[model samples]
Target: MEIPNDSPVNPEQVTSAQERGNPADMAQSGDFNNSNSKKKKAGAEAGTSRGNKSFSIKLAPATNLWTTQKNGAVKLRMEETCCGGVSPLTVAQMFQETVNQCGDHVAIGFKQTNQWETLTFAEYYGECRKAAKSFLKLGLERFHGVGILGFNSPEWLIANVGAVLAGGLAVGIYATNTPEACKYVAQHCEANILVVENAHQLKKILEIQNQLPHLKAIIQYKFALEVHQPNIYMWKAFMKIGEKIPDAKLDEIMDSQMANQCCTLIYTSGTTGIPKAVMLSQDNLTWTANTAGKMVDIKRAGRERVVSFLPMSHVAAQMMDIWIPMKFGAATYFADPDALKGSLVNTLKEVRPTAFLGVPRVWEKIEEKMKETSAESSTLKRKIAIWAKGIGLQAGYNNMYGNTSVPCGFALANSLVFKKVRVLLGLDNCTKYFTGAAPITKDTLEFFLSLGIPIFELYGMSESTGPHTVSQKNYFRITSCGKTMEGCKTKVDKPDELGTGEICFWGRNIFMGYLNMDEQTQEAIDKVGWLHSGDLGKFDEDDFLYITGRIKELIITAGGENIAPIPIEDSVKSKLPIISNAMLIGDKRKFLSMLLTLKCYTDDETGAPLDALAPASVVFCHKHECPATFVSEVLQKNDPLFQKAIQDGIDTVNRRATSNAQKVQKWIILEKDFSIIGGELGPTMKLRRGIVLKMYKDIIESLYVD
Candidate 1:
């Protein structure tokens, strides 16, 4: 109700509606215009229809819908989901034909230090077909499934396209996935060929190779620099086989690629449980990318040059790295292996990418940079910077999406101060700053938004083809996750008096269900067809959906009151200057608590510890005095940011609930952030809440103890 308030009504005085809104709106029949008997029949039908679906949209207020964002992004409104229409050229054709059209243009690349190994459209297509032919020579069938386990690189993407081009389904197992997890998917997919990156990756796959009956071929793209391995087929040797196929017939083979066939299987990181393989069809993927492209306008995409560092192993990265550029004929440049400071600066200066999509971690670093550099600056200077940020936001909105509400003086403010602010963050080249993979802290997103940097926070999962909803460039809000994609029917299943529930998605992009887990698939998608997202959400007066948290993850306490953890955690993280991520813990306990992580900052030169201005807009300590510690140290600082953040977290809970479900009573901070290597987080870097709870079981229990 405050700081980007959605509800016009005060949070304290809102009242709940009585009748659970009608689940269906049946057109009344002839004989009786809603008489008792007909009403009974109507009610029955409504109940049947609503059996799996949520409350009917006809009853919900409409203001909760998308209007606009400061991102300068335009919304392409569509009356229908463009399924079965222009029937997009399949992924393989899209890439090849684009390369054919833009032959000599540097189409894509992977980085090595300051240099880049480039591939023009022509070169890219040539490599794709040759690899495809070679894959066929290795005994790939029209229906064969090819699996890949690797880190992000051009090779990973090339092999994926080759599989699709050769009429094989590309199933990507998480490189971070365990041996048992890999075996399960490989066996279930019945993949015959496996393409892995290096010996270490291959070793993981080889551990369960004997258990996999269908796996017949294993090709390693990079040889282990350390030692020789005879069983693995070297990448260079494999390329030679690709020459065996006649070049004259390449086009003919690629044209036969079908759109409806399962093109890929990207398993979820399994933060919740066993990773479910999402069967992504070409039509589904093509549809999603095209839809998103229209919204972002990546075709006339201003920021044509992209520095892609996100994991290609994930769908979002694949969509951005492979699909977006192919659709727009844009040049995509890869950043160094490390998406951190040094490589980031080099890539930005060298490639000067026009557009960029970063997760919260990356953007937060930029925010941290602003605070660090301006540490000793006067209050007016910082406030002026904040004001200028608002101007930049206005200009960005006008430039990108064309809503253009900020008037002459506001416009003047942008030209004088905000424009330079954007360049400093290295976001001047960025046209659309996409925020996804996890919930972006609204405070952080707002800061970027105010600064004329466009940030789009979206919602989706591996099973939903990466995104079901995203904040439209022209129409967006800090609280809402934009409107649903054209055809998606999003609903809140159950509601307290407030009308929120388990989110259900039914759309063209919903995967062909989980791979091989037929029973689990059936359970996920009901008979009538609705992919249960498992996340809880509610739409506002504008029809924009605001997700709270996962239903299964919602902890019910001893008092039988259900508490959602994410909202509180998000508020806490957003308000803190140094806190990175937090996990909420209450479950069977009386009060909610949290496990926090502190972010380590670095000086501009060495990337070492540096001072960060607290939210008070005052610098607390210089490089020497900055303390690095856990929860105990944070409390000792007594800075305004810490107090504000902790208070905000509790206040958010109190404002949203009954007193029993208020802010957490206690919390602790861990020595480090959740990361993939430590297994506290997944490869995509989303925290595994369950895993954290287990790992810190004793630490979590202490708060409840006397």
Candidate 2:
């Protein structure tokens, strides 16, 4: 798809401002070459070739010393430095190395259905080899598309990396995708084979599998789980055949594909349309792993324990789960879907990971948990939390934007108040945290910091190799998405009071353009190769990039002041209990208003629900007074705990934006929760605001009709 020949800006956009601060300083820090450097560009650098390379996890210093069990079950015994290394390693090779050296090491701590299981490095590598060979035996050729459909599990990853071993690109479908959505991608990419875990996922693919005429095989991970059979291969029986392939030949076949070859199709989870299939080259994947590794400071020590819970189909989890750890041969514990509450907490205590990633939603849950349990703490405990949270936010800002102004008394505060706060959040053992994929409330963002968890908010898209801007260790601007990753150039197309504009990113990690759709691809990447992120941004006087909102999500009132609703919605929702999603409307008209969707957390099954609101008699505005989705019944059941949650949600967003653009007037109690299944959200669960506007067009009009 060719972009329309629209000349919006001058082609030469790489200004000194685009480079942010002293380019020389950043260059020294991140190995960045000046974009304005006199030298011309060349193709990617060929690192150590696979044959000459000992691509094992042991090479990373983090897992230098590991644990050896009496039963011959061994695992990584991490130290602080084990996870340290410049990353971006290939997943298949990481596994190869781990199995080769730490072959006996237990690599996976996975909980499936309800029971936990473990896979040793040797077993994990063997799994990938079989899967890869299975693909080849089933007719996978070089650069072929092998689609993956399922939730986060050992099987999901085994299939994804297996395809890589077979020299095929793994395109993961969101586990919750509708049949129609799945069909669109399968056909769009002309995938050669599709692998799924259970019968349910298979049912969705089977409905539309035939439409994907290019598909030659469908492999189900389980054996006994039978439904109406397709011309499919059972995973266990099929794997038996895969095991027969010689490992050396398998490496020969896959290695020949090279780093520049395409590795996966990462579908965009944009709210209003079919998700776009992001064509990631092997280089893109590795570069992302490399760039993100630098961003998070993934050291070899402690090799940073991580818990894999996010859907691996998306880039964040894919980077953290499938790519980053592969380079380090780090061990990741998988949370069980069933016993997630008890088991997730257990994993944190057991694994004590130093680094991890979470979405705003997950962080919110942690903040809520903190709020719920903190009430029972002593007065001194509460005071320390309040004081320490500010220092944490300052650290976050320092980590993101570059200028650091931590309070003078922080050392005293850290020792006195912040120490215990850290232990309560289970982040006591964690070094740093990554939260991204959507706007996050400042309160929640800072809360982790108060507890001594260095929560970093990052921003970017799959098109940009996962993350472009992230808070560095010393920078922390609550709203800034952090600084540009090393080797990236950023600029705002237009400036507001802040130097805010449409954030355009130019970097080596940018894609090789969207596959097949030359026009659309051309539209996204400008003439000089900057990927138009379509997100609004502003650099502070200090060169921090604050992501205001999506350009497409911008609402221009009749008065011409542009308001971004996310900050506002985030503020309001931060104070609310049981809010499923929030949509801020009233664009191109008068005052700002909103529509809120309220639903209980899936795991929040108790006598009193998270959906419960505060009493109408309280000083706080009830539905009768607020008129926002006034679910009186849910409100009547509201206990103090529930009320505090909702109020905190409200205060969170309210603290972010100015009053006019903030969620000033509101309505609540959407009929349904925003979900992938409900069409209210993107596959990643981001609210598709435009669809919500159109669906509730009349209500939005009513906000201004008077």
Candidate 3:
């Protein structure tokens, strides 16, 4: 039960210390490890290069930002006039600027005891500094990580910024991760302190605490600990630990930080293998927040408000919820933990944020819910909605195609139908709606457009910070990811006759190299500075970027015909209203086959797919004269009516195919729809193709069995 708080861990020891026990622990236990210190010194002399070209403006000399001082770790300036140019500033400095400008403005809001509570910018900043002191007091090593595993909350933000202010990296662990996955991230980052939401998340850490050699303590931020362990502490107690620590000590660590030094570690989904830690520097964060805000025209100070519900572990969520709000002095309201399951709409209505960001799945769910509700409306109301939607769709297309002429009856339609719908969904005040993290079908986009909601698309990955290209409300094509952000540049490498190739990114927002991953980092960033994104895309005459597919996700049939799966999948979903998920599977096979799942009810608590059909799917079945109420019943009866409907829809899609190889030759309905808990989707609700192909291997094999 002894707690090891005697020595500070070295960031250079992350890779080695995970395999071998903590070097500091060995030294304290009379097993002095001289070899570790030698290795650390060797790494320092070798130096880490992010391949960033020299900049005239360097913030400060790299000191103890990492155990091995890295060169080119202070360069945040690039020769670009985008977003009125960029500057070098640590996270601490950026946040302080906001506090100075809007000291009395509300920075964070959360519901407590069925009422709202708020925190001012200065008060929020003060709380973060207190957390930073506690981290330092708990022997948080410079450049070591503070792994936070929790839902989006004020405590999460405080711990994240506090870690950076204390000269450590802020690592957000997905709340849905397993114990083994949690161990990998914590061990990979050499985390000194762990923060969890409640007993459930705490159990994950307890199960793998032994494997995490550098984890010093575990703090539960949500509820009181029923049973206290040696190094376990409550939120209040943890915050008080560094009260006696001097302000000068925390300020000194902040002063030593550099803008280009890595301040955050975002882990990839690990669909292929172990998740890689994406190292985002202070400049990558601060610069992107300021510049992207400008690009989107994010309202300043109290004029902006956003509901924080998306998983903050993802770069998109972190940028939208934490960094952007800090830069603009906007208010962020924390949604309930079950926001993604079903309660999100209630939160949205109450908050009525000025801006909102939803992944493709989130928007799709909202679309489905609206359809279900509309089905139950009176005949006259439905007719009126239909009329309004037609006008709205026409007006939307007119605006998008650069026609300033608004369609006739547009104002009447908006006032009668669109206005009421927005108010009911709590989006009445929202001026901008963004969708990203996956490719959204044109069906979903047009559905929202018909309802007077233009959802902008964002394109980028963890390597590019968050967004490289963004589809703004003013200038956006129907399905394109829009133009690049002001200073960011995109190049399509090795384009074919159609100008389709891999997308590469270049800008100040480009991330520092992955943590402890040299070869992978080199592969990602070339000999020059461009970060080669392994995504296939093309640019139109207007310079708008369109993502075709991922390099790894592309399927090559046995006939040597290459096909992208997204378009085919989207076509199937659009043609068949009952189908919730569609995945094409014909790699190295004679012809393309598909795996489809019918829309079904899901457990509200766990998000587990249920056997009963959803309302929309049930309605579809009734319309087709099929009395089936569950997915199993449809298959058990071999319902020819339902089967023929699906077949006819697939036939329509096949007719539109460019070649025979592109057609879906066969398909089978899955018993359950894909869900995050089912291991078929990532946290952001993006389809996990590899996992799906493996999970249903026998079923897929049966389809192609001669």
* TM-score winner: 3
The Cα local distance difference test for each model comes to 0.61, 0.60, 0.79
How do the residues 423-470 of candidate 3 rate in per-residue lDDT, one tens digit apiece? 888888888899877777798899999988999988888888898898
- Encode model 1's per-residue lDDT on 361-478: one tens digit a residue: 6677777777787777888878777677766656655754456566456766667566667555555555666766655566777677676676777777777777788675676777
- Each prediction's TM-score against the native? 0.65, 0.64, 0.73
Better of 2 and 3 by TM-score: 3
Error of 1 at 328 (Å): 2.4
RMSD of each: 21.9, 19.2, 16.5
Look at candidate 3 and tell me the lDDT of residue 389: 94
Candidate numbers sorted by lDDT from highest down: 3, 1, 2
Q: lDDT tens string, model 2, 125-204?
A: 65666678878777776666788876676677878888887877788887766787677777876778888767787888
TM-score of 3: 0.73
lDDT value, candidate 3, whole model: 0.79
